[model samples]
Target: MEILEIENLAKHYEKFDLKDVSFKIRPGKIVGFIGRNGAGKTTTLKCMYNLVSPTGGKILYGGEEALKIEKRFKQEVGILFGESNYYPSQTVKNLTAVTKMFYDDWSEDLYRHYLQDFGIDENKQIKALSTGMRVKYGLALALSRGAKILLLDEPTSGLDPVSRDELLDIFIDLVGDKEHAIFFSTHVISDLEKCADDIVYIKNGEIIVNEDVTDFEASYLPRPPRQIRRYPSKRQAH
Candidate 1:
């Protein structure tokens, strides 16, 4: 069964317009939102969460309209943007404390497990964390709230290779239970190619490709990894 569906989704701005955007995210699957810059990827995701109002279209979560199921739907959805807007002075523990109040199903045990698993220091201020650590912290917060559907926008865009791989490993682990589904947007096609079950490509505010990853890869010419540098492991960096 489809967990989320976007039907004829469209959003309009003064200069740019996103039209006829449609897709489905099924249970136990990873759907990669792929597109070039200015392709409406961010806009589409914002609309899903009602952060940005859609001029036209309907979003359905489990066959019910999103607007109608706002309360229940919000609990099921967890969002992590490309760059989290965190107070630089706040520590990891402080951040989690503030966020946990919003979710009824918040799990402190799960949150601590992720903190330790990710090697994050709870006492360290947000400003002290590396780019990778910030993103990892964001994921921990989202997952601990018992989010069944994750909406990540460029979560791995600026991380090191080791961090990217680590995040991917966590994503793989999340889907292992067959209860979680993720829809993440990224310019990093190779990363998506590595793990995404399906790809939804958008261009000029229109969805041009929405299909299985294998089919999409088969039709397009392959490109090698962008960088060949050997990145130091987290242990080595520390």
Candidate 2:
């Protein structure tokens, strides 16, 4: 089933306008939103969450007009930004104390489990956490709330290769349940190439490519030289 849809969406500003953007995200799939730095990747994501009001078009979540968004919808959707949103002085334990009140389904046990699994210390202050740890903390909180849809903004940016791979593994495991959907924006194409089922390429405030990962890669991206040489010509030594 489709969990989210963006149809003819538009967001206007004096400096830039995101026009004619559209896409759908289904359960058990990971959709990668990709673009250059100035593209409307973040803006489109914000529109989905109602952080930015769209100038035109419709956003539907579970077949309901999302512009008339509801609180239940908020509970179903989890958001993670590129940077930490929590106060630097707060410990993970203390931050959980504040965040837990927002979700009726919040589970302390699961939250703590994620903390352990992600190698995050509950007692450490948010300021002391590394970029990857902070992202993990955010993700832990989101999962604790029983979110079905994850909207992540540049989630792997600024991380070392190992950390990026670790997060990608977690993302792959998340959709294993077959009821969750992940839509994340990133300039890091390699990360998407590894885990994304579909890729949405945006350029200068518009969507340029929205297609299955295998098709796009096979049709658009060329094979590396090493792989190309694997198929030897008959003239060459076997």
Per-residue alpha-carbon lDDT of model 1 for 41-104, expressed as tens digits?
A: 9999999999999999999999999989898899998888965549989987888788898899
What are the C-alpha RMSDs, in order, of all predicted structures?
7.9, 6.2
Question: Model 2, poorest ten-residue lDDT window?
Answer: 223-232
Where is model 1 poorest over a 10-residue stretch in terms of lDDT?
Answer: 219-228
Model 1 alpha-carbon drift over 4 Å, by segment: 223-238
- Can you write out model 2's per-residue Cα lDDT over 1-238, one digit (the tens) per residue? 5788899999999999999999999999999998888899889988888999999988889999876766877888888887675799988888889889999888889887888888888899999998778877787887778888889998887677897898888789888888998999988778888999999989999999999998888876666656444766788956
How does each model score on lDDT?
A: 0.89, 0.86
lDDT (C-alpha) at residue 155 in model 2: 85
Top candidate, metric TM-score: 1
